[model samples]
Target: MPNFKLVAPYCGVRKYDKRFFVYYLETEENIRREYIFNTDEDVSNFSHALENLTAFMNNVPVCKKEAYHQEFLDLLLREVDHKLNIRTDPSKPSAVALAIEA
Candidate 1:
């Protein structure tokens, strides 16, 4: 395989007993593709490439980034809290954001 660099990666996360993360990115040549981290090594390798994995929230069309990202952060906090005890919040965000960080 040829070497490729993925820039401005877009990520989505889903829970199926185990969380599944899918990353979408455009190559240096502008080729778009999606990748799934299927193993510990895959995640580890991806993390190594990204010193800081940041969220691309409210990224409409999964490319054009829009909206206040902090809202996503706040929602993430609430969801994490909910996970701690399974408590429901009236103002909870959507059940799924499919947040993938690469």
Candidate 2:
């Protein structure tokens, strides 16, 4: 439905740990989405990456890969924060906030 492109990339390495960063744009919405790749395999496989990503968005389990799973959850939270721009208390009735929290 939309064409997307990467606009920026950042990497942080600490000892044996590494993070791959991506900032991208979608023409259909004029939105810049950020992504962090937690594992090297995530950077290499287009198919598994897509599947892993979809599963993450749907809030499905990512098998044994907790790091990658958490990355997606964080991205979704950032998106909610970008949209809401509010300090959401845990007790509040924020469907948007609650969905993200979920």
User: How high is the lDDT of residue 13 in model 2?
Assistant: 12
lDDT of 1 by residue, 1-102 (tens): 112223233323222322222223222222222233345554454444332324333234543442233244344335231222122233433222212221
Per-residue CA lDDT of candidate 2, range 70-96, in tens?
A: 475466445332221212233434332
Pairs with backbone N, CA or C atoms under 3 Å apart (clashes), candidate 1: 11-100, 12-98, 13-98, 13-99
Residue 100 in model 1: lDDT: 21
Error of 1 at 96 (Å): 18
Candidate 2 has what TM-score?
0.21
Once superposed on the true structure, which residue ranges of model 2 sit more than 4 Å away at CA?
A: 1-29, 47-102
Q: Compare the candidates by TM-score and give the number of the best one.
A: 1
Please list all clashing residue pairs in model 2, or write none if there are none: none
